[model samples]
Target chain A: MQDLVKKMATELDLKGEVCPYTFVKTKLKLEELESGEELVVTFDHAPAVENVPRSLKNEGHKIMGIEQKGDHLWKVRIRKA
Target chain B: MKLGILLTTSPENENTNTVIAISTAARKAGHEVSIFLMYDGVYNVNKKDFAELVDKGVNIAVCALNVEQRKVGRVEGILFGSQYDHACIAADVDRFISFG
Candidate 1:
């Protein structure tokens, strides 16, 4: 079998939150990432979908993917670029 | 020459003012700008009240999925789509800036 590569994952759970706070918490967590590292953020706000990825993209980070879990929950994958 | 702006919050909230400020500033800088709205941001373009920004050449785009989620149809000048609408703007623009 081929070797399996697992990237380091950091999850920031900010369920039941709002804007700016979600952005701020995610940013602080992202600050700890090295280039190429991955962060998985979970939040319940739809705005977080736009705000978090947009904020990260503006800061020169890469958005790997965004996944919506349930009615109010989402998972955003961001890579430090 | 082109600037991609994303507003992810509602204007009813004070937080939305930041997005407007940035868009206003970009216009003052003389760049062609368009704003894509998603989530609560779809509400920002629910009326013609922001006509000044439109007059300034800021095209408004709202996420289609978000519009349905929020049940806000019949809003003028706000198109419905996914983040791709916004991403395309970012792809073609000289710069992408987002405010929430």
Candidate 2:
């Protein structure tokens, strides 16, 4: 069952950020991870939830899940593909 | 990755210069670039730098209504689109920037 539990290799908190920069900073962090590693990013900006996931998926990353952490705050888990 | 830039300021504004610089860098890196011009930014459609950028294969679209409203006098060479195209560009691009 240990392999069933996915572990996160990196975490990014992008609060109070806007488009392009949010995606830019997230992409940069993802670049530093090894293949098959997972990154969880926290975003306060509403649009980033849609934009970042779409952008990351376009770059061949897999979106594991998206969950709301608090009011207007969301977390996205991505796996390098 | 596709990068979309919304330019809504006039040619003399510093935003136009930033758009040119960012688009040039993105293009050189073999990345797709799209720029949507509206409001006063439609004035750049007639400028040399923006025209040269269009020649370099950068997708540049100008708002038709703004051009007519401002009497910028646009020719048929470039894409004369509307704000709908701007929204489409923003939705389609991987990253978006607004220079107003």
Candidate 3:
């Protein structure tokens, strides 16, 4: 059950990416997933964590949460709506 | 629908305030707003309203070359971009209004 739940998400490493593009790429990636699929995105650019999630949410997607990976790194989990 | 607002005038004029007002309203109405500041409009980046718009999830982009030429301080949250950014904003938006 744990393995199955973990496998539900597809990870995208957008480390070092910045805003607009970060939101853009995330939008594109979300389009590739089926409805209700999860995308775990890693981001180094701080604003993308805030910007991307809001942008996605505005586009009708669900933002799961944001977790700090390092001093400045962040991971955003999103579910397609 | 997404709205693209182009502001080419300086902050000393009415364009800055107008852009802020329109962008705020559009964002509040659940529309995506992208502001591309060019020419003398680079100074708008220093405006407090721009920060407020960014906080409201608005996309504000300033012209990099204009900022460099005019010696404007870069605002952290806003996108520092070029004509390409303007083109992208113009293309992606459903409706575009200019304050030029």
Candidate 4:
């Protein structure tokens, strides 16, 4: 039903890094999110499979979606409770 | 609710670990987890070794079309035949998320 598609508008940005580090930083921010809150994380790394979403879930956060715009830029959305 | 995690990258890529991290976390939080592997991600299942977290029951749903295109052997457990579709994925979960 795409119910989670409803955008809630929260933003978090992680810069100047690569794998594991980008994910590590993103996890730190998710700790502060409340249920149904949305977070937008901007990252420069090319491989997102291992870090971003994983770290979010590790902290009990929900990753709404991820969009890659051009090369070297990605915007990941997360919802935390 | 159940969740669908899309993995479209290869194991060699840095993103593979991120996908694993997210899937493991989802399972730990008590959410049903399934992964759809596409593009380079089809190779993830081909790997013989995985992290320790994989031992703990992770649901993996692979993209059949992608698998056939790559002509990889159909592995058991971690990989599933394309008989399952995205409609199945969306219907089977509370959330459908992608990682590329």
Candidate 5:
């Protein structure tokens, strides 16, 4: 079971950031990772939950999962593609 | 992807925000991004956010004629070019986005 746990290459906490900046920072962080590496991004802005994933998908990245951590807070796991 | 952004509007317009957002995103994606500031867009040379864009590796050029007309003098770290430079940037990039 331990071996099955996927390791995250990096984490980006964009709690106070807004739309385009959130996505922009995420993309920049992703660029620093190797292919197949995973990035964990946390968002406090509601729109980023939808916008970030969509924008990443458009760029051909793979979204592993998205989970709500608290009220109006979400985390998205993405695999570089 | 190599992207060319042709900006003809000034910071007074919301289009300037769009340009910054798009250019930032493109640069973050490791894409080559170039911005040609023409007409009123040359006025954005002094904007604080414009400096951030330059720091992020977005190549920015201002039109010589427009800069002189506006008396913007010399802004550090920004290239001053002519229409020919804009044409060359358009020809060199894979796609050109115009914001007027």
Candidate 6:
């Protein structure tokens, strides 16, 4: 069996960006996409892994997935809503 | 939704970051945002990051009284308005967030 990969409409690498900014940049990118489009954002800030998803969800966006890619890095898949 | 952000503190305060963060997020969410800067918050009009907010299309207005008190002349990108403008912002927006 094989897991299906979700296609991302856009991607952001915020590896060195901090909290709020991690979410801030993600929010900005989401605005540039059409509704229902997907965005993949990678960041190393631990708090953002939690904060970004919460904030985005609050704004009515959908969180497709969150994966830990390394000791300090994580990736979030979001579908604009 | 239309959003109103009232900022009363200067950039020295941590809430300034909150102001920037929230306004940026609100703008990106396709909401119209108006930020009313009063008291020491007027000082933030010159900060580098604050300029980004203006560029992001957040309507920024500084209190005319505070601008005069601080001896700040007209700033290019910021609007100098009276308390009436602030009242209008409060009345117009569907949601308001305050950072002091």
Model 3 regions more than 4 Å off = A1-3, B1-4, B8-42, B45-95
Runs in model 5 with CA error above 4 Å? A1-81
* Pairwise lDDT winner, candidates 1 and 2: 2
After superposing candidate 4, which stretches have Cα over 4 Å from the reference?
A1-81, B48-54
lDDT score of residue B33 within candidate 3 = 93
Tell me what fraction of the real C-alpha contacts between chains A and B each candidate also makes: 0.00, 0.00, 0.00, 0.00, 0.00, 0.00
Q: What is the C-alpha lDDT profile of model 4 across A1-81, one tens digit per residue?
A: 245544456566665665445665666676676666677888775444334575457557777778887677788878775
Query: What local lDDT does model 6 show for residue B31?
Result: 92
What would the per-residue lDDT of candidate 1 be over residues B1-100, giving only the tens digit for each residue? 8888777778777656666677788889887888888778888775455535776767887775567678876454454444545766988899887777
Q: Distance (Å) between predicted and true CA of B29, model 2?
A: 0.1
- For each candidate in turn, the TM-score is 0.53, 0.54, 0.57, 0.48, 0.54, 0.54
Judged by DockQ relative to the true structure, which candidate is superior, 1 or 4?
A: 1
Mind giving the per-residue lDDT tens digits that candidate 3 earns over B25-56?
A: 88889999999998899888887876678999
> How well is each residue in A1-81 modelled by candidate 3, as lDDT tens digits?
746755889999998666556777887898899998899999987656755776677678998889998998998989899
- Location of the lowest summed lDDT over 10 successive residues in candidate 6 chain B: B79-88
- lDDT (Cα) of model 3: 0.82
Candidate 5 on B1-100: residue-level lDDT in tens? Answer: 9999999988999988999999998888999999999889999988899756888999888776577678886577777755545766888899998999
Give lDDT: candidate 5, residue A34.
89
C-alpha RMSD of candidate 1: 8.3
Residues B8-95 of candidate 2 have per-residue lDDT tens digits of: 9999999988899999999999999999988899999888887789777799877765776788876555667655457679889999
lDDT of 2 by residue, A35-58 (tens): 888888998876568667876776
TM-score of chain A of each: 0.87, 0.89, 0.90, 0.70, 0.90, 0.89
After superposition, the stretches of candidate 1 with alpha carbons farther than 4 Å from their true spots are A1-7, B1-49, B58-100
State the weakest 10-residue window (summed lDDT) of model 3 chain A. A46-55
DockQ of each: 0.04, 0.02, 0.04, 0.02, 0.01, 0.01
- Stretches of candidate 2 above 4 Å error? A1-81
